[model samples]
Target: MKFFATCPKGLEPVLFDELQALNVEQPKQTLAGVYFGGGLEAAYRVCLWSRVANRVLLEFHRGPGETAEQLYQSVQEVRWLDHMRPAGTLTIDFTGQSEGINHSRFGAQKVKDAIVDQIRDETGRRPSVERLRPDLRINVHLQRGEASIAIDLSGDSLHRRGYRLKAGMAPMKENLAAALLYRCGWPDKAAREEAILDPMCGSGTLLIEAVLMAADIAPGLMRKEYGFTFWTQHQKAIWQDLIDEAEQRREAGLQQVKSRFEGFDSDAKVLNTARDNARRAGVESLIHFERRELSRLSRPTGEEAGLVITNPPYGERLGDEPTLFFLYQHLGERLKADFAGWQGAVFTGNPELCKMMKLASDKTYKLYNGAIPSQLQIFNIRQRAVPEVVEVIDVQDDSAEPAEPTVVELSNGAQMLVNRLNKNLKQLGKWAKRQDISCYRLYDSDLPEYAVAIDIYGDWAHVQEYQAPKSIDTVKAFTRLQEVVAVLPQVLGFPAEQIVLKQRRRQQGISQYEKQDQTANFMEVREGGCRILVNLQDYLDTGLFLDHRPVCLQIQQQAKGKDFLNLFSYTSTVSLHAAQGGARSTTSVDMSATYLNWARKNFALNGFAETRNHFIQEDCIKWLKAQKGENFDLIFMDPPTFSNSKRMHDVLDVQRDHVELIDLAMGLLRPGGKLIFSNNYRRFKLDPQLNERYEVKDISRQSIDLDFKRNQRIHQCFELCRTE
Candidate 1:
C-alpha cells in the first residue's frame, strides 16, 4: 500500500532519513509531508519508529475538485463502504490549500456528508462521526485544485504514542521531541555512560522520548487500538506478529541501552506529570524525574560526559523580561560552573534567550514543532583556558608627589613617550586608510603621563590611562602588540568587531565575572518593509533578535488584511514590521509607558500612520483580562520573563502563566485568525498545551541572526492558528 507520513515542515528530510535507515523503499518527499510504499507490517513499523512523522496515512484515492460540491462528489466517488463496515464510527480531517474551499471544517463536513450519503443510500446505515476515537479515520487534502483522500492507519495522531498518560504545561509532541534528541546525535546504546537531561522538562517529553528511542521500543506498543484494525482487510495474525517482533526487539535491546535518562522541572505539578508520563510509557523505573530549575542543576555522579537537553520557558510563558534574561544568564553560568565536561543541547524557538546561555555551540539544526521553526543548538562544554601572564614589572616612583611628566611630540603630528619606538598616529592612520581598514592606531602616548590614545578609522577614539605600568616593555613592543590587536579585527572584522584594552586593579579578594561590554555604536537595519529598525550594537543584543525572524516573515507573508496586535511591545518591533508589511492596523501594549513611547518612536521612524498605530501602557494580563470580547486578525505576544503579576493582578510570567494568557489571547483572535507568541526565558514551557483546538508551530530558526552568533537560541517563537 502507498502511505503518506505527515511530519512537521522542514522535518521531511529527517523522516526520509529514518525511512532510509530502516531500509524502507520508494520514499518520496512532499510539501510538509512525505510518501512511501510499504505493507501493513511496514505501516506498523513506520508508525512505531519514524521519529519525525506525526501520523501515517494510507492513501486511498484522489480526484479533481473546483468547488465544495465538486469536492463532495469526488469524495463520494471513493469506495468507502468497501473499506469499513457501515456500523463503524469514522472521523474526517481536511487540510491544505484550495481556492473557494478554505474552511477545513466546511471541507471536512462536505466530505463527511458525501461519505455518509453514499454509505446510507447503499446500506441504509452510516458510520457516526467520532472525533476522539474512530474506527476509520480519513484525511482529505485539497491542494490547489486537486483532492487526495487517505485512511489514517495509525488512528490517533501518532504523537499520542501512549507513553504520556499525563502532561504538564506545553508538553512537546512525542515524535517531534524524540526526533529532536535523535538529531542531536543521541547515542543509541543505553549502557554507554551517557546521561540524558532536560533542565526544564515539562511532563518529561524529551526525557521519555529519549528513553524510548534508546531502548528501541516501538512507540505503537502502548497503543490499544489503530484505525486499520477496523478495516475489512485487517490481518490479525500479521499485526500480532509485528507487535511480538517489536517486543522481542525491545527485550533484546533492553540491556544494551541502560543509560541514565533524567528530567527536571521547577513546577511540582509538572514533575508529577512527568512521573505519570514515564509510568504510562512503562519506563518509569528507568527514567528519573525531578523538580529542579536550571540554576539548581547539579552534575550527576560518575558521569564525565553526558547530554544536557532542555526546552526552557520563553518570555510569553514567563511574563517578566529582566527576570528571564537573568534566569538565562544564570543557566549559562551554572552550565559553565557545574557541567563543564558535558555536551549541552538547548531547544528553543527564541534566539535571543539562547544567547543568555553564553556558551558557544558547535552545531545547530533546524527543527519544526508544527509550524514553528525551532533551533536545536549543541554545545561542547570544556574547562576555560587559564589566562597566561605575558609579563611582570615592578614600578618605583621616587618623587614625594609624582611630578607631572613632560609631553613629547613626534613626526606626523603624533605624540608619544620621548624615548618610545611606537609608530606615530598619522602614519598609523595613513596605513589603515591605505589598507581600507576601519581600525588601525590603538594606544598612543598623549595628554596625561599615563594616558594612551587609540583611533578607529578617524570615526571614533578610545583613550585610557593607568597610574603605573606593570608591563611597560610589553606595551612598548610594537611588533607583538600590533599582531595582538590585528588578530581581533582579523577574527572579527574591524569596526564590526573592535575592542579597546583597559586594565585596572580591583580590591583584593574580589572576584569579577565577565562584564558585558556596552560601548559600541548601534546600527539599525530596516526590516525589509522599513517598518522595524533594529540596532545591531551597543549591547550583546542586536536591534532585531532573530528567533522571532521567522514569525515576522510569516506575518509579512500572511498579514494582508489582518489587524495586528503586539503585546509587551518592546520598541514595537513586531507591530511596526507587521504594519509595514501591510497589516490594516496595529495596537501595541506594554506596562513600561516608557517602552510604549519608544514604540511610538519606532512607528514614526517607519513612516507609519500615528493614527493607524495604537499604543497602550497598561499591564498586558489586566488589559487582556479587561477586554472580554476583543478579537484580532494577528496577535504577536512576548510576555515578561517572570512576574508576580498573576497573583498581584499586575504582572505575569509567561512560563508560569502562559495557559491563561493563551486562553485569553485565543479569545481575542477572530475566526480564521493567527497569533504569534514568543518568549526569551530560557526555560519557558507552554501552559495547558493545546492539541487540536489550535495549530501551534515553533518558528525559532528564522529568528536567529549574526548578532546571536555565540548562542543560537535567543527566544522561542510559536505560531497559533484558529481555522474556521
Candidate 2:
C-alpha cells in the first residue's frame, strides 16, 4: 500500500529522512509532504511516531479531474463502501484548483456528493457530513489537471497533540515547533545529554514537543481519536500491538532520559498553563517551568553547552514593533552573555526583527505558522570577542597631531562613497563653516548607486535612503546600503550610534510627519544665528529642513519689527528665526497638535514668550479662511506637496490648490506686506493670473543654498506682493 505523510512546507527534507528511518520504501518529495511506497504497518508507524508530520494519509485513487464531471467521476471510483459504512460521518478537505473546479469549497462539495451518491445508491443510506472527527476524512488535491485523492489517517492535524488546554496569545502550532527544533539541530544536542531552553515559551509548546521527541514517546499516544478510529478498514490488533510496544519503550526512555528541558515566561498565569501542558504531555517531571522575565534569562545550572531555542512574539498582532526590537536585542544579548558555546534558534514571523539580534545565523529556514510566513534563524552562539587593549599616549603639545591619517581598507563601493564624501566635505565643509551653517546636506545621492541623502546636524548624521526602483535587485540594494552605513562612521568621524538611518518613500497624507520611533532624542544645532532642536530618531524629518535653510534666513533677514505669520509651520523653525530677527509678533499655524506643542518648545528654547509668539493648532487652510480680518507684514506659507490628514476638512494637493492657498494667505497680508509662498512639489507651477494680478518674483534659485544648488527642484519659492 502506498501512503503519504503531510508536514510543514519547509521541512520536506527532514520528513523524507524520517520516513527513510522508519523503513518506508522509495519516499519521494513534493511541495508540502512526502510520498512513499509504505504498507499499512509503515503508515501506522508514521502516524504514531512522527513528530513533524501533520497527518499520515493512505492514497486511495489518482486520476485527471480537469472538469467538474471528471472530478466527481474520479472521486466516485474510490469504492466508498470499502472505507466506511453508509451510516458513518464523512468530510472532504479539498485544496488547489483546476480549470473547472476553481474554488476549494466547490471542489469539496462535488467530491462529497460523489461519495455520498455512490454509497447511497448501493446501501440505501447516506453518511452524515461531519467537519470534525469524521469517520472517513478524504483529502483531495488538484494540481494542473490531476487530482490525488487520499484518506486522512491521522486526524486533528497532529499538531494538536492532545495537550495545551489553554494557549497564550499567538501560540505556535506543535508541528511547527518540532520542525523548528529539527532545523536548529535539537535532536543532536538532546542525544548528547545537552539542555534546551525557551526564554519566552508561551504555554510550553516548544518544551513539551522537545520532551516528547527526546523521551521516545509517541506524539499521538494521548489523542482520544483519529480519522481511522471509526473507519471499517482499521486493523485493531495491529494498532494495539504498536501502542503496547510504544508504551513499553516510553517507560524505558523516561528512565534513560538525561537532557534538561526548561521554559521561562514572565506571565504567571501562562506559566501555570505551561506546567499543566507539560503534565498533560507526561513530561512534567522531566521539564522545569518558571515565571522569570526574559531580561533575567540565564543558562541552566551546571550546563556548559546546549541549545537556547525560542519562538518570540513577532509583534504582528499584539505588541508594538519598536518596543519589540529591544526585546529581540535583549534576547540576543542574554544568549551571548549567559549561554555562550550553545546553539540558539529563534522563530519569528517578522524577519526584520532578526537584524536586531545582532547575531550571525549559521542557517535560516523559511517556514510558515499557519498562513504567516516565518523564519527559523539558527546561530552558533559564541562569546563576544574581547577588544584588544591599546595604550594611548597623551600628546603634550596641542599642536602635535598624527603626521598622516590612517586609511582603512574598504569594499569598492564603500571606497567610492568614501572618496565622494571626502570631496563634498572638502567643498561644502568650508562653505558651511564660513556661513556658520551648522546643519547642511553633505551628500544627496552623489553616487547614483548610493541613493541616500546624508545630512549633518551638528555631531550626528541622519541618512535617508530613497526607495530604490523595483528594477533594482533588493539584495543588491541592501548590500550597497550596508556598505554605505559601514563607511559613514569612518568617513564622517561619527560613531555608529550617532548615525540614524531611515528609508524615504513618496509621502502620502501626513504619514511623513508620523513618528517612526518613540525615542525623542533631540539635539541642538545652530543655523542662521538661531538655536534649533532637531530630533534625528523620532520622525522621518529632523524637525528642521536643511534645504529650506536659505528661505528661513531670508524671512529672518526681511522681518524687522514686522508682524509675521507662518503657515504649515512644522516645529516653527521659520517662525523662531523670524522672531529672532526682531519681528513685533509671530503667529504659527499648523494642523498637528504635536507640531504646535513642538513649536511651543521651540519658542521657549529661543526665550521668546508664548504670549507674543502664538502657536495655533488648526488646519492652515481653515484657519486662514476663518480669519475675518487680519494683517501681517510678512507671511510665510510653505505647504506640503500633498496633505490628506484626517484632521483636515479636505485634501490639500499643492498643484491643484496652490492658487487658492496663495490667495488666502495674501488676504492676511497688509498693503505692502510680502507673502513668501513655497512648496517642495517638483512639478509645481504658479498660476499665471496670480502673476498678472500681483507682483510675484520667483526666488527658487535664491532660496536654494550652496549645498542644495545641485538639486534645484528641492523647493520652489515665490515672493508675492500686492501690485495696486
Candidate 3:
C-alpha cells in the first residue's frame, strides 16, 4: 500500500513533480528519497512512466530497534511466506545510519540469516541468496536506531527500463538522460515536425529516450518481471487492467508520429549500439543512427526549425587543451555556417567548451552527471547578414616609450587589427605567465581611446577593458568579440571559449572626457556535483572560485546532524555541499540578493530542500551585528576584496577587515565549531593587531589545483577554532 521512489541527490523535485503529474497522490519527500501510497498497479505504472526516479521500493514494515538481536527478531516477525515461497530465492539490501549497525553489508547478512532461519524452522526449507536474480528482493533502512523494511518493487533500477539491449562506453543512465531531455522542453509527440540530434551520441541514450517519448511507449513494457508480481497479494485482473490502460494510451499516441529523430557518433561501434537500442525499444523504424565527425555534420534538408541536442566531450579525458579548443572552434563554425534556422541545446561539463560554440544562448539549465554539475545551454540561431569591415587612421600608443609608436594602417583594415591581437594573445600569454606576472597591460591609447589589459592564469586568458569605438557606424562589441574568438585557436593554441572577453562601456550623462568603466562577464559551470562560476577561458578570478572545492567536500563529509552557516556566501557553493552531504539544515548569508538568488537556483538545480536551507539577503556584518550567542556548528566566511554598497553600514574590505570579521565570527561559533575563512586579494597581510582567542591554521595547501597551477597564491584559506 506504501512505496518509495529513490532518485539521485538533485532530482527529487523533478521526480516529485513527475509523480504529481501522473496523479499519484500524497507523495512525501525524504532525504534522497520520496514516499507515496499506491497499490501494485500504481507501482507498476510508476515504473513504466516515471522518468526521473531511479528505483521504486515497496515498504514492508517499520519498527524501533533495541540491538542486533532486536533487529534480527524484527526481521523474523515479517510474514515472508506471504510473498516468497520456501523454495524461492531471496536477497537483502541494507542502508544504515544507526550506531547499533556498524556495517550495512553485515546488517544485510544478519537480516538474510534471520529470514532463512525462520523459514527453515517453520517449513523445513530456506531460500538461498540469489545475487543476480531473485524471487524476492528486500530492502532495509536504519536511521537514529529505527529501522524501516521494504520490498524492492522494481527488480532492477528503473533506469534500466529493459529497452537498452546495447550500450557504448560511458553511456548515461536512461532515466537521468531522459529527465535532462524533458527539462529541455522536448515534447512527447511523434508528428510535431521537429527534429532531435545528438552530435556526440555515445550509444544514443538521448535519441532513444526521444523516440520512446514521441511514440508514447512506456519504458516498463520491455521488462519481463516486477517485484510485485511475485507477491501473493498481486491481483492478476488489476495488473491486466493497468496494462490494458497503458496499451490504450500507447495506441492513441501511435497516430501522432510525424517528427524525425537521429544521432551521430564518430565511433562506428557506438552507432551500432544506438541502432540495437532502438530496435529493442521497437522504434527502429522511426529513428536514424549515423557515424560522422562533428565537422562533417550537415543540415537536414527541408527543415526550417529543429532542436539540436548534444553532449560534447570535455578535455578531462583527452588531456589536450589545444585539440579541444580546435574542436570547439570547428563546432561553432559549423553551426553558424550550416544550421542557420535551428535552435540548439548543448550539454557540457566544461563551460569553456560551451563558449567555443560562439552563439549566444537564450536559456541555461543546470543538471548533474554523477557528481559533476553541468549546464544545458539553449541557442536560437536565426539568419543574419554579415557586416563589412572598416579601418581607422593613425593613433598614438600611450604605453610605448617617448617618440610614441604610431598606429600603422594595415591591409585587411580592422580585420588585421583583430587578427594581430588574436595572434598576440597566444604569444604574449605564454611569455607573461612564464615571467610570473598574472596581470599585465596589453595596450593603451587615448587618440582612438582603447585601453586593453589581459589577465593570464593557468591555460586561460581574460581580456579586459576593450572599449568599442563611439561612432554610430562602428560594429557592435559582441561582433568584435566573436571575431577575436574565431582566430583564438590559431593564435593561442587554446579554444575560443577559453578566451573570455570583458567589455568597457562609457557611463551616460558623464563628460566626454571621463574614462569608461569595465565589467567582466562570467558564466557558471557545473562539474561533478559542484557549481563553478567563472569566466570561460578567463583567468583565475572565477565568480565562484574552484579553489574552495576541497573545502566544500569537507563540509559535505561533516554535514550530518550539523546546522551550517555560510557567511559572505557567493552563490552558496558550500551550502550546496552541505545539503548533498545530508546536513540537518543550512543558512546562507550574503550581502548581494543577486548572488543569493543565483544560490537558490543552484539549490533548485541540485534538488536541495528549499525550506531547510535559507538564503539571507542582508550584509553578513549587519546580520552578525544582530546576532548574540554561539549557534552554528559549521561556518564558512569568505569576504570580497573590496565592496562599497550604499545599503551597508561600512565599506567592506577583506584585507583591512579580516581581524574584526574573524573575531566577530569566532564569538558566534558553538563549542568545538569549525570555521573556514578565505580571501583572494593578492599580497594580503594577516592582521597581527588582534588577540589570539581562537586557533588558526592555514588550509591553502589543500585548495590549490592543477588547472590553476600558474597562480600559487590565488586565494588563502584559514581554519579557525575557539579555544576550550
Candidate 4:
C-alpha cells in the first residue's frame, strides 16, 4: 500500500527520518505530509511509532475535481464499502480547494454523498456520517483541478498522543513540542541516558513527549483504535505482528530509556494536570512533575549533561510582553550558572524578547504553532568565552606593567580610545551605583579621538558619536567610529541591540524639528522621586536632559500646590516632575505636536493624567505673548538659543530674546511666584536689562549635574521674579 504521513508544517524533515526508521520504501517529502510505498504492516508500524506524524493515509486515487460532479466522480472511484462496514460511520477530512469547490464543508458533503451513493447502490446499505471518532475517515484534498482521495489509516491526529488531560493558557501543540526537542538534539541525548527539563512546562506536554520517545512506547498504543484495523484490506496477522513486536520492544525499551525527564510549573493546579497527564500516558513513573517557580529552576542533582528545553509564555496574553524580558534574562543567567555544558532551546513567538537572554545562537528554525509563527533558538549553555582585551597603543613608558596580551588588536588611536572609555566607566559607574542611579552618563568624549558619549540606561547603552569635523579624513573617521562600536559592547558588557547608535550633528533650519523615526519608543527612568520617559531612538536628543537633572529635582522640591507653566517643553520631563511634587495645575507649551503627544504619554505613564494637566501645541513665544489674564504660581522656560523654525513668527536668539521672554514669563507670575529661565548657548549673554527689571539670580552652578561638571557651558540657568 502507498501511504502518506501528515505532520506539522515544519516537521516534514523529522517525519521523513521517522518514516525511514519505520522501514518504509524510500519516503518522498511533500508539504505538511510525506509519501512512501509500504504495505498494511508498514503503515501500522508508522501509525504506532511515529511521534511527529499527525495522520497516516492510504491514498486510493487522483483525478479532476474542478466541478462538484467531477469531485463526486473522483471520490466514487474509491472502494468505500471495502474500508467500512455497510452501516459503519464515515467522515471526510477535506483539505485544500478547487475553483469549483471553495467551501470545504460543501465539498466534503459532495464527496460524502458520492461515497454513500456508490456503496448503497452496490449493496443497498450506506454508511452513516460521523463527525467525531469515525470508524473510517476518508481524506479528500483538491488543488486546482486535481483531487486526491485516501482513507485515513490513523484516526484523529497522531499528535494527540492520548496523554493531555488539560492544556494550560496558550498551550503548545504536542507536535511542535516534539519538533523542538528533536531540533535541540534530544533523541541523541536520550540515547546517552542524558536528562531533560522544562522549567515553564505549563501542562507538561514537552515532558510527556520526551518520555514517550525515550521509552519506545508507541504513541498510538495508548489509544486502542486505528482506522486501518477495521478496513477490509487490513491483514489481521500482519497488524498483530507489528503490535506484538512493539509490545516486546516496549518492555526492553523501557529498560533502555533511562533518560531522566522532569517538568516544573508555578501554578499548583496546572502542575496537578501535568501529573494527571503523565498518569494517563502510563509514563508517570518515567517522569517527574513539580509545582516550582521558574526563578527556582535548577538541574537535578547528579544529572548528566543533557538538554533544557521549554516553551515559556510568549506574553501574548494581555500586555505582558515587557515583563517577560526580565524572566528570559533571569532564566538565561541561571542557566549559565548551573547548567553549563548542556544544550538549550527556547521556543517563543516574540523574537524581540529573545534579546534579553544575552546568549548567542547560530541555529534558529522558523516554525509555526497553529497560526502563530515562532522561532526555536538553540544554544549550548557553556561558559561564555571571554576574548582577551589586547592593547594596541604603546601608551606605557617602560615603567608600566605589560598589559595582559589579550585585547583585540586595534590602531594606536583606537587603543587609546578604548583605554580612556574604560577608565571613565570605572569611576562613573561606581559612583552612579553608589547613588542608586540606574541611568547615567559614563563617558563624554573625555578623549578627543573618541568623540562619543556613552550613557547607561538600565542594562542598555546609548552611544552618540559626534559628527567629525570636515578637516578630518572621512575613511579614518569611519574606521574610528567602527572601532568605538566594537569596543563599547565588549568593554561595557552590553548586547549590540541594547546599545543604540546615533550620529549627533548640529541641526540647522527646521531639520531638528522633523521626526527622525515614528517608532515613538519610550522607557520610564527614575530621577529624584519621579518617573520620566526617555526615547533613545527616534530623535536627535533623548527626551530627558542629563545636564538638567538637578533642575528637575529642584522643580519637584518647589512645586507643591502651585500652578506651573513649562515653556518650550521638549517631552515635558520637567513638567512631569512638577506634577509629581503636588502641582495643582500644569500647562506645557511647545510648538511640536509630536512632543506634546509624547508628553501626554509621559503623563499617563507617571499616573499623572489629571484634567488640569494641559498640553498646548503652539509656538512658545506665541503662547507666552497670548497669555493676557493668566498669572502662574511657578514657571520654567528653557528656550533653544537659535531656532529658525518656520513654525515660529520670528527666529529666537536667546541673547536677543531673553529679556523679552523672561519679562513675559515674569508678568504671568503671581506674587511670591518664581520663573526659572535656562538656555544652552555657549556665548549666551543674559540681557542686563532683565537683571535690572526683575530680581534675577544666576543658579547655573546649582543646576549642573556631577556628570556634566566638565562641560559647564553645556547649559546656564537663572531664577527671575517680578521686582516688588
Candidate 5:
C-alpha cells in the first residue's frame, strides 16, 4: 500500500524525517507533504505517532481528469466498495484546478455525484454526505488535467490533538507548536532534563507539546476517532496491538520523564484556559501555568538553565506593532537578565519586529502557521555587555555658577546650518507666536549641503532628509545628517529621541500613504483654534500638512452657514476647520482608508458629531463623477500630483485631469457657491478654457503663509465661481 502524510508548508523535510523514523520505506518529500510506500501497520503507526502530520492518506487511484465529466467518470471507476459501504457517510475534499475544473466546489460536487451514483446503482442505497466525522473522507488532487484520489486515514487534521477544547486568541496549532519544538531542539533538551518556559504562552499550546514530547507520549492518543475506524480494510487486531504497545510506552515514559515546563501570560482568563488544556492533555502536574506580564518574567525557582520559547503576537491578531515592539524588547531584556546560559527561541510572523529584541540569533528556521509565513529565531542568552561611562571633571569657578558642560564640536557645514536655523527661528518664532501657530516649518533646505526640511510641531521637531544626489559623497552626507540631529536637541530644546527622522524620496502613486512604521506615535498639536494629531514617525508626511495651514484657515473663515465639501481631503484638517466655523454639513472624501480613519479621529477629538460631518472613503474622482445634483455651498480641492493606485479605476495626473476635476466639483456646487482648487504641483497651469466658463481668481499669494514665504511656489490656489 502507498501512503502520504500532509503537513504545513516548509515542514516537508521534518515530516520526511518523521516518516523515516516510523520505518516507512522510500519516503519522498513533496511541497507540503511526504509520500511513501507502507503497509497497514506503517499507515496506522503514522496516524497515531506523527506529531506534525495534518492528515494521513491511503492512496487509492491515479487517473485522467481533463474535464468535469472526465473527473466524474474517473471517480466512478474506482472500486468504492473496497474502501467504504453504500450506507456509510463520506466527504470529498477537492484541491487544485484544471482548465476544465476552475472551481473547487464544482469539482467536489462532480466527485460526490460520481460516488453516490455508482453506490446507488450497485446497492440501491447511496451514502450520505457528512461534513464531520465521516466514515471515509475522500481526498482528490487535480493538476495538469490529472487527478489523484485518496482516502483520508486521519478523519480530522492531526493538529486537532483533542486536548484543546477551548483556545485563546491567536492560538498556535498543535502541529505547528510541535514543529517549533523540533526545530528548536526541545527533544534534546528534554533528554538533559532541562526545563522549558514560554512568557507569552496563550492557552499553553507550546508548553503542552513540550511536555508530551519529553514524556514520549503519542500526540494522537488523545484523539477519540480515526478515519480508518469504519473502513473495510481496517484490521482491529493489528490496531489493538499497536494501541496496547503505545499505552505501555506512555505509562513508562510518564514514570521516567524528569523535565518540567512553565507557561505565563498576562491575561488571567487565558491562564485558566491554559490550565484546563494542560489538564486535558494529562500533563497538568508536570507543567506550571501562571498569569504574569513579560516585564516580570524571571526564571523558574531552583532550576538550571533550559529553553525559553514563545509565539508572541505578530500585529495581525492582538495588539498593534508599536506596543508589540516594546513587548519583544522586554522579552529580550528579561531573557538576558534572568535566562542567561540558556537557549531561547521566538516564533513570530513579523520577523522585522525581532530587531527590537536586541539579541543576536545564531539560527533561523522558516515555517508556516497556516498561511502566515513565520520564522523561528534561536539564540543563546549570553551575558550582556556593560556600558562604558565618560568621566566628567568638575572645575571650580570664582563666579560660583555651574560649569558649562562640554561643547559639542561641529563641522563647518553644521555651523552654517546652525546659523541658518537660528536666523529663521528668530524671525518666524515671533510671527508664529503672534498667529498662535504650534505647527510650522522652521527651515526648508536652507543650506545647499544640508538638504532637509525641519518642521516643528509644538516642541518636537520633524526632520526629513531629502535623498542626496549621486554626486555628493555618501560619507559626507551621513556626517552632516548626524550633525543636524546632534544640533536639534541643543537648538530646538527637544530631546534627540523626540525628533523623528525620515528619509524623503520622490514617492509615486499612493506609496506616500504606505506606513513607514507600524508605530502609531501620534502627538497632539494646536493648529489655529483646533487640536490636530500628527504622527511624525509613521509616514513620509505628517497627518497635518504645514503648507496647507492658510488654505484650511481660508476655508474656515468663509465656511459659516455653508455646506462644505473637501475633495482629496487627506486627514480632513480643512474639513475640521470648516466644522469649527459652523458649517451646517461637512463632507470629506479620500481614497486612503488610513487617512480617513485619521480624519474620523480628528473629528472625534474636536467633539464634532459624526451625524453632521461625513467621511467617505473612496477615490475623489470616482465619487465626484458619480454625483449628479448640486449639494454644497463651498468646496475645497487639493489633489496629489500623480496617482496610479491599484484602487483607482484610472491613473490621475493633476495637470491633465485638473480641468475635469474642477468641472466635476463645480457641477455639484450651488449656483452662487464657490470652489477653492489647490495642488502642490509647482508648475501647474490652469486650463485656459476654465477661465471662460467660470470666474477664476489666483489666491496663490494669499494661501502662502509667512513660514512658507521663502518657498513661494510651494503650492498654487484658485477660487472658481460660476459667472452668471
Candidate 6:
C-alpha cells in the first residue's frame, strides 16, 4: 500500500527522514510530505511516531475528473462501504482547483454527495457528515483533471500533542517546534545526555517538545483516538501491541534520560500555563519552568552544556519592530554573558531584529511560522572563562544539592528567632483576618540577635534580614539565617519557594531608589478595593507600603469629585485609589522613569479609560515650583526623608526642607482643598509657624493600622489646609 505523510512546508525533508526511520518502504520526499509504501503496522507506526507529519494519508484511488459529474463518478468508483459504515460519521477535505471545480467547498460537497449517495444506494442509509470530529476523515485532491482519494489516518493534525491548555500571545505549533529542535541537532545532543533550555519559553511548547524527545516518549501517546482507529483495514491487535510497546519505552526512557530540561518566561501567567501544559503532557517532573526575564537569563548550573533555544515574540504591529530589536539585543547580551560552550537557536519572523544580536549565525535554515516567513538562526557559543563571580544577579542554581549538614540543627539564637515568628504569626494572623487584610507585617526585629522583617503578601512572604551589626559574631548570624531558611517553610505551612529573601540596610537618600537587580518578578496583592502590583525581588521596597493601607483608603474617600495630586508617588498606588474614588482628574509626579511607567501600568490594569489621569516625570520638589494654574482639591505628599542622588539636581532633606516643601505644595491647593502630608521619619516635627498659617491636625495615631501597633512611629500623617 502507498501512503503519504503530509506536513507544513520546509518540513518535508525531516518528514521524509522520519518515515525512513520508521521502516517505510522506499520513502520519497514531496512538496509538503513524504510518499511511501506501507502496510498496517508501518502505517500505524508512522502515524504514532512521526512528529513532523501533519496527517498520515492512505491512498486508495486516482482517476481523471474535469467536471463536477466526472469528479463525482471518480469518487464513486472507490469502495466507500468497505471503509465506513452507513451510520458512521465522515468528513471530506478537498484541496486544489480544476476547470470544473474552482471552489474547495463546492468540490468537497460534490465528493461528499458521491460517497453518501453510493453508500445509501448499497444499504438504504447514508453516512452523515461530521464537520468537527468524524469517525472516518477523507482527503480529496484535484489538480488539472486528476482526482486522488485517500483516508486520513491521523484524525486531527499531529501538531496538537493534547498537552497545551493555554497559549501565550503568540504560540508556535508543536510540530514546528519539534522540527526546529531536530534541525538544531537535538537528537544527537539528547543521546549525549546534554541539557536543553528555552530562555523565552512563553507557553513552554518548545521545552515540552524537547522533553518528549529526550525521554523517547511518543507524542501520540497523549491522544485517546486517531483516524486509524476508525479505519476498516486497521489491525486492532497490531495497534495495541504498538501502544503497549510505546508505554514500556516511555517508562524506561524516563528512567534512563538524565538530560536537564528547563524553561523561563517573563510573564508569571505564561510560566503557570507552561507548568500546567507540562503536567498534562505527563512530563511535569522532567522539566523546570520559572518566571524570569530575558535580561537576567543565566546558565542552568550543574547540567551538561547543550542547547539554548527560543521563539520570542515577533511583534506584528506597526511599531513592534523597534521593540523587538531591543529585546533581541538584550537576549544576545544575556546569552553571551552566561551561556558558554553551548549551541543556540532562535526562531523569529523578523530578520531585522536579528541584526541586533551582534553574533553571527553559524547556520541558518528557512522556515515559516504560519504564513509569515521566519528564519531558524543557529549559533555556536565557544567556551570562555574569566570571572569567578557570575554577572547574573539573584540567579538560583536548579541543579545544586543541599550539603549534608553535620552541624547542629538550631543554635540558641535560631530557636529564639523561630519562637518569635510563631508568636507574631499567632497574634497578627487573627488581627489580619478580622480587618479583612490580605497583606501585613508579621515580625519586625522582635529579637535584636535575629534582626529580620517578615511580611506576608497573600500566600507569599518577603523576608528581609537586617544587615547584622559589625559587633555580632559572623558565625552565629550565618547559623541564624541557615536555621531560618530551613525552619520557616515547615512552621508557617507555606512552602520555601514562596519566600523571597533580601538584606535590609539603611540608605542615606537616593540610594534607596537604586535598582538592586534588573530582574523584575511582579505579583499583585489586594489592598482594600485595590489590586496593587509589587516586585518582591528586584527592589528595596515591594512597591506597596503595607503600613500605609489606611492612608491609601483615606485618599480614596476624600477624592470624590476632587482634582487629586500625588507627589513623590513611588508607584502611584495612592493616585490609583483616587481614580477609583471618582476623582475628576489626577496627576502623579515622580523622578524615576521606571516608577512612573509602573504607575501607568497600574492605571491600565484597573481599566481606567479617562484621559484626565496623568503621570509626570520630574523631581517632586522641582515640579512643585512650576505648578501655578493647576489647582488640586485633594493632595498627597510623601517624600523621602533624605535624597542625595545624581538623577536630581537638588539634594533634599525632608526634615530641613519640610517648611518650604509644605508651603510650595499648599500654594497649589484650591480654596476648599485638603493637603495630606506624611513621612516615616520617627523624629519628624512640624514647623511652629505653619500652625498659625493653616489648620493642621496630626492624624498619625488614627492613620496607623493594627499591623504597626508595635511600632506606632512607623509614619506621621497630618491633615493641613488653608485656615479660611
Ranking by TM-score: 6, 5, 2, 4, 1, 3
Tell me the spans in candidate 5 whose CA falls farther than 4 Å from its real position. 385-724
> What Cα-based lDDT does every candidate model obtain?
0.66, 0.84, 0.69, 0.80, 0.86, 0.83
lDDT, candidate 1, at 366: 81
Q: Which stretches of candidate 2 lie over 4 Å from their true place?
A: 385-724
Our tally of clashes for model 6 stands at 0
Task: Give the range where candidate 2 is weakest over 10 consecutive residues by summed lDDT.
Answer: 386-395
lDDT of 3 at 126: 85
Model 3 Cα lDDT, one tens digit per residue, 1-724: 8989998766777788788877776898876767888677678789778877877888878876547877888888897888789988988888885566788887898789889998898899988998768888899988778788898878777888787877765567888787777766777323456887777788888988887777777777778787766766667787777788778877776567678887887566778888888888777887788766564666788776677887766645432343354355456666777778887778777767777566898888777767777777888877543311111111335586533222333335345655545555556566555644333323232113224444443445566555655662355545444544454444445544456665644322212112223333334344334433443322223445556766777888888778899998877888878877767678999866656665765564343434467889888888887889988888988887777766577878778788888888888888999888888777778765543667778888776544344455768888888777
lDDT of 3: 0.69
Candidate 3 TM-score, C-alpha based? 0.54
Best by lDDT: 5
Q: What global local distance difference test value does model 5 have? A: 0.86
Per-residue lDDT tens digits for candidate 6, residues 148-170, read 89999999998887998688777
Candidate 1 has what TM-score?
0.55
Question: By the lDDT metric, which is better: model 1 or model 3?
Answer: 3
Poorest stretch of ten by lDDT in candidate 4: 386-395
Cα lDDT for residue 166, model 2?
93
Q: Which residue runs of candidate 3 sit more than 4 Å off their true CA positions?
A: 188-191, 316-322, 382-724
Q: Write the per-residue lDDT of candidate 5 for residues 251-274, one digit (tens) a residue.
A: 888898888788987566788899
Candidate 1 vs candidate 2: the lDDT winner is 2
Greater TM-score among 1 and 3 belongs to 1
After superposition, candidate 1 runs with Cα above 4 Å error = 97-100, 189-191, 385-724
What is the C-alpha RMSD, rounded to one decimal, of candidate 3?
20.9
Can you tell me which runs of candidate 6 are displaced by over 4 Å? Answer: 317-319, 383-724
Higher TM-score: candidate 3 or 5? 5
Q: Give the TM-score comparing model 6 with the true structure, all chains together.
A: 0.58
Give one digit per residue, the lDDT tens place, for model 4 in 178-220. 7788787787899999999998787889998898778877777
